[model samples]
Target: MGEDHMERLIEGHKRFLAEVFPGRKSQFHLLAETQAPEWLFITCSDSRVLPDLILGTGPGDLFITRNAGNVVPLTSQDVDGCTATIEYAVEVLRVKHAILCGHSDCGAMKAALDRAGLDALPKARRWLQHVEAAFAHRQPVNSAEGESAELASLIRGNVVAQLWNLKAQPSVVRAVDEGRLTVHGWYYDILSGRIEEYDEELRKFVVLGE
Candidate 1:
């Protein structure tokens, strides 16, 4: 069954090479020369968490970092791929906006809740500790909003926690301090197909602006 899926993927690649790539060949060549991506998008490693497809963004438009839970780790000494990528994006790539996006029905958040499932993967269990900060940062739960208020709060909390982690990044901190970068926290709802942004001053989640 997986072989069939692989065959389909190969066929799709052939189509891109034959059709899509030919038309966009020159554009791709130029991109290969230099990439001036404007946004640093931090999202989950989930197959469904495709920022480009959802945001209508192209390769040169975004610098992305993906991980299980879209986590941004603090505690400066512990270095990892996500932080390294973020540092490069902020300091070298000079992306103007850094966005930390979390989603509904996240398996990572569910794992955090369950705890037991994470025990087997010691590294992952330790990594998820970073998300605990999300609890304090989460906005007040809206009971009217469908689903468990507790779960929603945790999800929202993760966004806030990761956003803080994003800010604490040295590169992000320097860029923001220089007034050259803006940071954002977003929650994407799979069921509704809508995104909500965290408003720092308002301390609430609002539908993204037009």
Candidate 2:
């Protein structure tokens, strides 16, 4: 089964090289030279959250980083992949927009809500501590989510908590203060396939289109 999966991936690459790459050869060549993406997208590592597919973004359009729970640690001394990527994206890439996105049915949030499953996964157990702040930031549970309401609320709260952490990053602060960057928090509902943005002034999540 593993070999079959690998073969499928190889075949997919071959197809891209043969059928897709030629049409986009010029675009790829230019990207090969240099990339100047306008957006820095940070989101969960869930396989379902395909940034390119969900946003209609292609290569060179977004500088992206993903991790479980889409966390941005608030502790200033905490140095990890997420913070490093953020600093580089803000300072070097000079991305104008930094989007921190969280989604419904997230495993990280689930684990954070119930820690029994994480006992065996020490690293994950420790890492999810970053999402503990989600409890205080929990959004109103949407009745539409039915039994999943609590989990969904927590996930949205995580988005807000992480977004705050993102903003507090030294580089992010300077950039925002200088009017060089804008930060956004988003909650994506898998069932409805809609996105909600956290409104700073309103202190609530509003449908993205609204």
Q: Pick the candidate with the highest TM-score.
A: 2
Tens-place lDDT digits, model 1, residues 1-210: 599989999999999999899888888999998999999999988887779888999869989999988898888476799999999999888999999999888888888888999878998898788788877875676687676777888999899889988898888889999999999999998878789999999888999983
| Tens-digit lDDT track of model 2 for 1-210 | 599989999999999999999999999999998999999999999988888887899999999999999999877465799999999999999999999999989999999999999999999998998999999999996797844888988998999999999999999999999999999999988878888999999999999978
- Candidate lDDT values, in order: 0.88, 0.92
**TM-score: model 2 vs. ground truth:** 0.97
Name the lDDT value of residue 44 in candidate 1: 87
Count of backbone clashes for each model? Answer: 0, 0
Report how far residue 172 has shifted in candidate 2, in Å: 0.4
For model 1, the run of ten residues with the poorest summed lDDT:
138-147
Estimate the TM-score of every prediction. 0.94, 0.97
Candidate 1, residue 109: lDDT = 87
Question: What residue runs in model 1 are displaced by over 4 Å at the alpha carbon?
Answer: 144-146
